[model samples]
Target: MLTVILYHVIFVIVVYTDTGPPYNAFPQKLNFYYFSLYVIPSTTCFFIVLLSTIFLVVKVRRNQRWRKGTSTQTAKTNDKEDKLVRTIIAISTIFIICSFPTVSIFITQIIHKQFRYRDPYLGTLLLLMFNIGGVFQAISSSVNIFFYYRMSSRFKKVFASLFACRRSGIQGTKPSD
Candidate 1:
């Protein structure tokens, strides 16, 4: 899959780069490592997801246009399709927003060569940006659970049933006989 290839390519680049000295031993080397492991992956993933999302949106819209004004059933189907596309777009947009700070900070560092020599302020700023990105990334990933529960009645039912089963198991109960 594309994800597999992307990971492989980044791994190779990280391994092949002459990063000099072990990780965290030198501030400069640590900065390079951080950017490689965090920034590059986040940026690449954002673009990959963004492009695919755009392509999928276009395809879904085109299909909608082709099938417009067909039948009541088709209209229902279109509505569901639109909701699914919207959900996907929401998720991808969140990803890009979450990743922007990370990518921008690292790219700025690279452009300015800020990491070539130790600078405590830059280090603090990088850490702050990294933490912010991490928080947003976590939110972006977990928000889909709520979206599924809200957007799809079936998902809501299934999700509720799943938790109900867990609760029953924990209570060691078989509903009143």
Candidate 2:
């Protein structure tokens, strides 16, 4: 929950920072090549994370049932359902934390007045790391189902119940009391 909020705040900061006239004017003034790789790819990752995380979470919940009057923290002891929920949480966490740095970098450029941009070589290296991290975040979001399989007990129970119900109905058998 906090992670989600933190990511949202960082995302907004990234957008408004460095994107404005001052930072924009610098590159036009200095023509620094280092800013190219760092700023572009890092910024790109931020947006990709924003889009993909939303897509992943929405898709997970689209047809899923939420048990009324139940706390999500309580696992169903069914490994599958628990794994699913845990995967969702883990993926969400990864997306949020991963997005922070790239966005923060943009924000830093906007805030630090004296530096006049750090060394081009160092900046390029940092930016590359930022972009790579973002790629990992994307991959994490995409492959989260595998994590869910390994960790969530509640996910298992719910999934089993759903499948069991479906199978019973197909056979025209009475549901267990």
Stretches > 4 Å off in candidate 2: 1-32, 66-82, 110-177
Instruction: Provide the TM-score for each candidate, comma-separated.
Output: 0.74, 0.38
- CA lDDT of each prediction against the hidden true structure: 0.74, 0.60
Residue 77 local lDDT, model 1:
81
Per-residue CA lDDT of model 1 for 35-58, tens digit only, reads 666667767777888799999999
Minimum summed lDDT over a 10-residue window in model 1 is located at 15-24
lDDT of 2 by residue, 90-172 (tens): 76666667667656755566565332336665567656766786786677567766555556557667877999999988899
lDDT score for candidate 1 against the true structure: 0.74
RMSD of each: 4.7, 13.8
Tell me model 2's lDDT, rounded to 2 decimals: 0.60
Misplaced by over 4 Å in model 1 are 1-35, 69-73, 115-117, 171-177
